[model samples]
Target chain A: MEVKLASSYGFCFGVKRAIDIAQKYENSATMGPLIHNKNEIDRLQNDYKVGLYRDLNEVKPNDTVIIRTHGIPKQDLKDLRAKDAKVINATCPFVTTPQQIVKKMSQEGYSILIFGDSEHPEVKGVKSYGEDLEDVHVILEKSELDNLNFKHDKIATVAQTTRKKEIYLDIVNSLILKNKEVRVFNTICDATFENQDAARDLSKEVDVMIIIGGKNSSNTKQLHTISLENCSDSYLIENETELDSSWFDNKKLCGITAGASTPDWIIQQVVDKIKKY
Target chain B: MEVKLASSYGFCFGVKRAIDIAQKYENSATMGPLIHNKNEIDRLQNDYKVGLYRDLNEVKPNDTVIIRTHGIPKQDLKDLRAKDAKVINATCPFVTTPQQIVKKMSQEGYSILIFGDSEHPEVKGVKSYGEDLEDVHVILEKSELDNLNFKHDKIATVAQTTRKKEIYLDIVNSLILKNKEVRVFNTICDATFENQDAARDLSKEVDVMIIIGGKNSSNTKQLHTISLENCSDSYLIENETELDSSWFDNKKLCGITAGASTPDWIIQQVVDKIKKY
Candidate 1:
């Protein structure tokens, strides 16, 4: 059996930068899980003493606090600064761009539409930036647009950095059809595109596909969904222990891809474990 | 045969306003044909002494010039004013909105993409408003997007008032897929939507469809195109004289629609002639 890796996968620029920033400040605490990967966060804690605080209330006045890659809401950041905690922002630039666009467009009197999961922290943070929160809408499906009644004829939309581009386009097309003025900002990161495209291309050539990343990672789930379209025997796992030996018994070629939050060390361990099959 | 008319058709607000403005100033000349219909222009000339000029050079000092519904270029308007001609701007507010957006977005360093015919006067005028004319592009088809290399990643797109909404959405979707930031202004008029939607609904119910307006009218052509999709026996004609009696020979019901440039008198003549069949 032969194993192939996707041409582009794992640890995107923002995640890598966030990890580096955390490692530099030993004994510091992150406002949230710095990245989605639990194993990486555990590693940072054990090796560098970088701890994760699930809530802002956990941070002490003198503690060093690192913002997660998904970013915290505007009020949360202001509160953290007001508490006198030393802060290091690790929010991805791609994520920040949409935040700025939402704030600017909202202030300019355009209603904001965010195409992402409403409950996701990234979307919540982005939604908070809108000048008029009442006019801000976060929707995961195009069908949800029907329920929205905007105060303004002008609409500005931004997508989560890790969302599927096809779904974003569908939402945008729907907005254009119904609205008078639509301002669409394609904020999905380049890394997401490259990784997903590579996974799709590799999955078609293999009998089975293995997607590795945090179970909660959006991009990882997106990769798994795309891979399943081309290869039915696709599985998403966080690490080597989740891989089933029987699944690869009849497969001649196996394709592997990892989400942006996945670390290279974890990918190496998965690859090494799969070799024994 | 029973004759039916689309609920919404003919003489949109802009065209009605232009005709009213043209009628107010007798012995005046329009920089271009006031509306697309030749018959309407001829009527204006004979009744109101409103003549037409093919070029700005034809305008004499002190000549009262009425701008067409589809605006002339910014420079042309300036030249007309500089030539001491009293210009009555009858440009549709819908069309003017896109021109203003393009000018503002371009001046703010965004590239302009006009999803319309390059030869269309409205598209040409909109393109001319871009601060850097070199960064403005006019395209009719989605495939044409492949050849365009925008000078700026920030793109502002606007459609011609009469363009099909589906085609404009296609162009916008393609642009969003390839670009980073896209600002889309749905400059398509409500009248176009109403007329097209009515034509589509009527065509589906009738055995034969008749679309009336100037042959060169974009909205008329769009209605004809849409009608042909639902009813194979769709015919486009400028007036009653062009209607074929044979089209009604076997048809139990005929649906009629007219473009924005079409006047009520022409629609009545067509309806009267169709009843004779």
Candidate 2:
């Protein structure tokens, strides 16, 4: 029996930087939970005195306000600057790149099409940049493409930074067939692709795979999906306590991976517990 | 043995109209071989003294010049109108619809993408309408779609009226994947689809299929291709004399279909020859 960890797992550069910034400003109130991992957020609150506030109005004068790694809407930045709160911009640079692209292309008269979950914060942030344009649309799935009836022929597209590369390319391929002109900007970050590929590679050789991350985290959910496709015994857990010994009853090999938002301490706990099984 | 004709086959409305207009003006010279059928052109030339002239320079002053069924370029129309020749416009309305759509869309600043053979007269005619515009492209196959790189996002597309509906739709399906915004105008005439569908239906129940049309006819070639896909024993013939009795040996059921330009007499002769076999 053997247990292995993915080559690329745990907190990415952006998430690491965000956590370091939040820890640097101890007792600070983040605009939202600093990251999707509830265990990490509780640790920050109890150990470092960091607090989570869902709304901008919760931050008082002179109180430090840290932005989440997913980034905020452009107007929110302006409104924050107008206040007396100490602002910490923790938006992932990879996510920022798409926001700027949407703003620039929409200004050039190209209609904007975003390939991602419309309800996701990262997608919502990107969509806000193009919301001022007359022909902005968010396509959550390929089936939604059939409902697109646009007067403007010019079109520019961007994907959520955490989206799968193949799904984005598949949508772009379909768009080219229906339109004479198309401009595509690959905005998905390297971290997301690396983590997904590593998890997929590990799952193929393992009998049972454990994915550790917040249930609400988009990238974590994506890793679980990829792992499950390659290995049906894949399970998503936020912590070691959720692990069941029955899952490893006859499993000779086991694989483990964590989402970008997951902390090193939590991953080590999950790995240590899985080894005991 | 059973011999059957497609429920909807023979000269289409556009071809019939062109023939009627050409026959009305005796001793007239057509701009090109008015239609694709060589036998029909020869019959008109010998029986009615109508001549086929490749160049506009061949028509004498005061001589009648009939436009071909596939239509001509916009510049050719201007050059024809500049002379003192009696002009009889015989451009097929179905083909003309795509030409006008291209001209209108291109004039409105939309880049035009045409799906058809670049060298075909109908495509050439449609391409000419948008040649004055900055961006106009002709894609004959789905493979050529990769070469399409455009700065302008607005895209409008039209297909040659005689093109197979499935081929055009397949290209459109592929284009939709690539472009953010697409405007599709299904320019394929009903006659082409009806004929192709009828031929395909007959081919399924028949042991052998005979496709009658000019060797150079686009729609006829499409029908032959469709028939061959369903029945490998399908054969394309220009006239009754080309039919071989050896092909009929062991073939219990035979289906017949003709191109839009093939005259009724040619189809009748081919049917009689096939019956005698």
Candidate 3:
């Protein structure tokens, strides 16, 4: 069997930057998981003594706290700062753009429409940046636009950094038709687009596809979704331990793609284990 | 046989306003057919003594030159003003809006995308309103977007007054995905939307659909297209003379929908002819 990897797989620039920063500040506690990948978080804790704390209450006043790549809400950052904690901002610069836009556009009285999953931390954090939280709406699908009743004819929209560009534009177009004026910012990062495109391209040429990343990772899920659409025998696994040899029974070619948060070490381990077949 | 008319059919507000303005000025000549319906133009010439001239050269210095409902190119307007002719601005308010947006947005360095037929006068007039003619692109289909090489990241789009909303929105969505920023003005008139919707509603309950308006009428052709999709036995007719008795043979119900430019008198004549069958 032949094993092929996507040309643009493994950790993206933002995630790599976050890891590099966290590694330098050993024994520091991250506000949340530094990135979405579980194996990477485990490795960080075991090797570098980095700690993961979900809430601000868990951090000591003088302890160094590292912000996750997804960033924290404005209130949380204020709370951290008020406690006199040493803060290292590792928020992806792409995510920072939409936060600034939401704050500026909302201040200008344009109702903000954020195209993203509402429960995701990136979306939650971006929502906090708006001047008026009441005016900001997190929409996951196009159908949500119909449910919206807005008093403001002027609206502005921005998408999460990892969102599919097509879905973001679809909602923007619908909003543009209903409102008199709309300003849209395409905030999807180039790395996310490249990873998805690479996965899609690899899937088309392979008989069986294996996607390696955390199940909860949005970018990972998107890659798995794109792979499944192109190749029927596609599986998403977090680690090599979950890989089944049965998947390679009749497959001549196996394609692999990892999400943005997935580290190079985990991907190499998965490839070595697959070669054992 | 039962005859039914669309609730929102016949002369729309803009067309009616143009005709009302023209009737008030006797012996005046329209730059072109004031509206798409030829029958109405003939009626104006015979009863109202308003002639239709295709060129500005035909108008005397003191002659009242009535601009068509679709409006004229910017250069033509300037020439008419330069000649000191008495000009009646009958350009539809709905059509005038996109003209203003194209001019303003283009001046602000936005590449204009017009969802319209390339040969249509209204689209041509709107295109001429842009600050740079080279920056304006008339896209009739989505595939044309691939051929575009845009220098500016900012794109502003508007649709012709008679276009389908879905088609306009589809192109806008595509443009939004490709461009960094997009400003869209949905210029499809309310009357056109209402007429198409009413036609779709009527087609569902009828055995045969008869669409009435001028052959060259864009909105008329759109109505016929909508009718054909819902009811296979749909036909387009300009007047009572085109009605065939065989179309009504064994037909229990027939629905009639007139375009925005179709006058009430012509619709009545078609209904009368259908009733005789």
- Estimated TM-score per prediction? 0.81, 0.54, 0.74
Candidate 1 clash pair list:
none
DockQ of candidate 3 is 0.41
**TM-score of each candidate's B chain against the true B chain:** 0.80, 0.79, 0.81
Best of the two (1, 2) by TM-score: 1
Which residue pairs clash in candidate 3? none
Supply candidate 1's per-residue lDDT for A179: 78
Q: Kindly list the per-residue Cα lDDT of model 1 for residues B19-57, writing each as its tens digit.
A: 989999999999888887787899999999999999899
Worst 10 residues of 1 chain B by lDDT: B159-168
Q: What share of the true interface contacts does each candidate keep?
A: 0.89, 0.00, 0.62
- Per-prediction DockQ, in order? 0.68, 0.05, 0.41
- lDDT, model 3: 0.87
Candidate with better lDDT, 1 vs 3: 1
Q: Candidate 3 versus the native: TM-score? A: 0.74
DockQ (C-alpha) of model 1? 0.68
**DockQ value of candidate 2:** 0.05
- Model 1 spans > 4 angstroms off: A1-6, A161-163, A190-193, A196-261, A268-277, B1-6, B190-193, B196-261, B266-277
Residue B50 accuracy (lDDT) in model 2: 89
